[model samples]
Target: MSTAPLPDLVKTVIVPARPDRAFAVFVEEVGAWWPLAGFSVGGASSSVAFERDPDGRATHLVETLADRGTAVWGAVTRWDPPHALAFTWHPGERADAATRVEVTFTPDGDATAVVLTHSGWEARADGEGARTRYDTGWELVLKPFAEHAGSSR
Candidate 1:
């Protein structure tokens, strides 16, 4: 018997942009699409940064209302342009217990299909919840990406 759930960690969306453009938005323009209300920093993030090199850092910096508290989120596991991006998602939770998020982009005609797989939650007690969160998160992320891509053309 398998302890894993029915659906694996993969969530895919087809965007109306080439692989490079789609990849750039995820790395460069993430702050524009990231939902401030859902951030783990307990504040609205001022800037989101993603380092492209392997083992690089993907950081989300947010400032609290009191101006006395500032928080940063994320860790990078893999970075491959126009192909895949993988990182750790800790937000407000324990960084060590965070799950891994892998996103891949494959060319599909004039568009690119984005496949996001957030796994490594198999060991967490709240794996089901985490999966549910990502399931919705992908929709949030992809919707704006698609809209933005459509407008650009």
Candidate 2:
């Protein structure tokens, strides 16, 4: 196989909210909008959240299994509200094999343009295959987030 790096997966969505609100909904209310049943290590009944520090800053993302066990999806590397958030992603895998994901929110008139970029695929053994899956996976994952972000809270 070739040793070339895989291309980054980029997806964007426009939500009917300001940048701040869009960012908040994406991070704070992820458990409600994330399609856990389809895209989780812990099955449908599992819940996911950004675990916070004592000062309320998100430190990592964790998935609480149906059996009360937990799987750490990733650790927060960058957290800038209403603008950007990034982390090392390796759900159901070891941290040493983690890839990177970065999301940015920009104001677009009355809406917010949310952009998600998943990269660092070369770190995984199945980098190309995983990238191919996530190429479409993000669409399924972000649909609910866009809808929920537009809905009244």
Candidate 3:
């Protein structure tokens, strides 16, 4: 048993694009930007998608396998356009077994300050390890998002 407290991971990047564009590229084009090689439940070659409904509602973030099967990585809990998005994040795990990930796109002059905060690890059984892992994990995941946001502008 460990007495280490669960931690909240926060990472921020200044995207060259505006707030709306940064948010758009981050949420809408996730399949193109998210690195699937090392971070997917669909294995190394899997493709990921941030699926949204016709009504501007985010449905699921899923990973598609080479064999065409799918893994539900998370569900969108908040979908505020061009500003903020919050979701449950626990790929290949039960829906209830999830942590909360919230990202905010703040307008910073001509650029957007994209802040990502992952929390709720206190509820996880593997709290300490998971907290430490995602401390590094989000940096890997969001690196491409920053690049894409810059390039798409």
| C-alpha lDDT of all candidate models, in order | 0.68, 0.93, 0.84
Best candidate per TM-score, number? 2
TM-score of 3: 0.92
Q: Per-residue lDDT tens digits of candidate 2, residues 5-121?
A: 988899999999999999999889999999998999988999999999998778999999989999999999998987999999999999999999999999999999999999999
Best by lDDT: 2
Candidate 1 weakest ten by summed lDDT: 57-66
lDDT of 1 at 26: 74
Clashing pairs in 3: none
Candidate RMSDs in Å, in order, are: 3.9, 1.3, 1.9
Across 20-39, the per-residue lDDT of candidate 1 in tens digits comes to: 89887777777666665554
The segments of candidate 1 whose C-alpha lies over 4 angstroms from its true place after superposition are 1-7, 43-46, 51-70
Using TM-score, rank the candidates from best to worst. Answer: 2, 3, 1
